[model samples]
Target: MLGTAGKGVGGAVVWFTGLSGAGKSTLAEALLPRLKAAGKKVELLDGDIVRTHLSKGLGYSREDRDLNVARIAFVSHLLARNGVFVLVAAISPFREARDRARATIGDFVEVHVAPPLDECIKRDVKGLYERALAGQIPQFTGVNDPYEEPLAAEVTLDTSALTVAQATSRILIKLRELGYLEESELARAEAPGNAASAP
Candidate 1:
């Protein structure tokens, strides 16, 4: 947590890994403005959006998956080194890929957002689980392919069990615990009537 810091001295990657509909993107979107409001230079990189721009035409094969992850890691690394806090919300199913990312982007916090598969099926917001279960989609993580759970993620949240506010609060707590966030910033964030106010 202390070696290669973000941009000037506070850059870090809050890497969120999980199933497609497990709240990674939603959480990243929610976390960014909070960090920024606390005076942190943060950026959110959603997986699907990255696929369209940073990793166009990448297939679903293992090699392609690795490539996509590496590409995301590369961008996050650059930003982190330059003092930008990168909040990445990617399914990044492979542990090795996550390891590569951790190595590339120092001062990283890995948060695993995993709801039970059955719950995911029930909440299949995009019909992804149903399609994958019915053999309509190939190489779907958690349905057809694999999701290597993080053995030691800095934070793990089950969306089914925790509200968005609760989950985000947990992450903030960890950032403070890791010395990534200052107590004053956290107090400002938690204080009454200042949730959406700018820094």
Candidate 2:
């Protein structure tokens, strides 16, 4: 169990890591408002948005990727320690950075959003996969680049098989199971109009 007594209140980092089109942002966006409604101070650090700001000018090299993940982890660690539910949606392809993040932020819940690579390709609205496959984008994750899946994630959701609502519900259940949320709040969190309005 993670310590919440001395830290003020519920402050845990719910990290969503996976391939680019694996629905990490979708789930994080779905969960954010519900967490706010539940009276938790929450912040979402999206990979694309962060890349434009925090990781500007960083290339696609392994060192750059690791540095990007490190910056996100550092921010997450600060937010989490200060009693904020930080939702990070990043590819974060390396396990080393994630392990360091878990160590840094003691109360960390890693949610690995893993779907089949083919499924991700099919769902690529941005045509990132197509471009990467065509060699237009170098070192893109899951194509020329690598995505190291989590060996033991607290929650692993296969977006290919599960509906958005179902996947979000499973994450909420995990949060409750880990004692980040109250048992009485599960139904409310999982309720249909709360966070997951999309099918």
Candidate 3:
């Protein structure tokens, strides 16, 4: 049920975790179309989008963050069991909450999108890193608050070392190895015409 060749009875959840500006959401967005092209029913649950809608009242406290992660995991579990591949791009900083999500969603793949802290700061388009460093924003994940790196992620992509396409291709290969995708679909995705094939 979990890993059939095509249009399986059950679907998997690919969870992306990282600090702000670390490219978790970007990577998830990049992979969305490829999954759809493979004929899988896929849904993307982005952290900012989820916070604004699903967990609107939640604050940035540790308890609140864990609750938000739980809510995402709950929805992802429901979708995955119903044969929808769920891509969750959340800066779920706490390893404990992430592990809990992994347990809740049995067919889960944890992807740690970690670039260096300095690199993440450099990529901050919203200038959140600057504000946080200036003590304007409290409880920021990488600055004021702690971000517990994944102890054993199924896939780890450092945006500084790998291009977006290369990182995405690696994720595709992992998904194929895990049986959520077929060999033919993988071939098509990595073909010369596909962006994921770019060097």
How many residue pairs clash in all the candidates, one count each?
4, 0, 0
Quote each prediction's TM-score: 0.92, 0.92, 0.93
State the lDDT of candidate 2 residue by residue for 1-199, as single tens digits: 2233223364889999999899999999999877776777899999999999999999879899889988888888788877899999999999988887787777889999999999999999989899999999999898998888899999999999988778888888888888888866666666557858655
| Candidate 3 local lDDT, 1-199, one digit each (tens) | 2222233457889999999988988888888888877777889999999999999999999999999999999999889888899999999999999988988888889999999999999988899999999999999999999999999999999889998899999999999998888899888777665654332
> CA lDDT of 92 in candidate 3?
97
Local distance difference test, each candidate: 0.84, 0.86, 0.88
Q: Stretches of candidate 1 above 4 Å error?
A: 1-3, 6-8, 193-199
Model 3: weakest 10-residue lDDT segment is 1-10
lDDT of 1 by residue, 1-199 (tens): 2247643375889999998878888888878877877787888888999999999999999999999999988888778877788999999999998998888777889999988878768877789888898999999999899999999999999998887777887888898888888898777555555343221
Off by over 4 Å in 2: 1-8
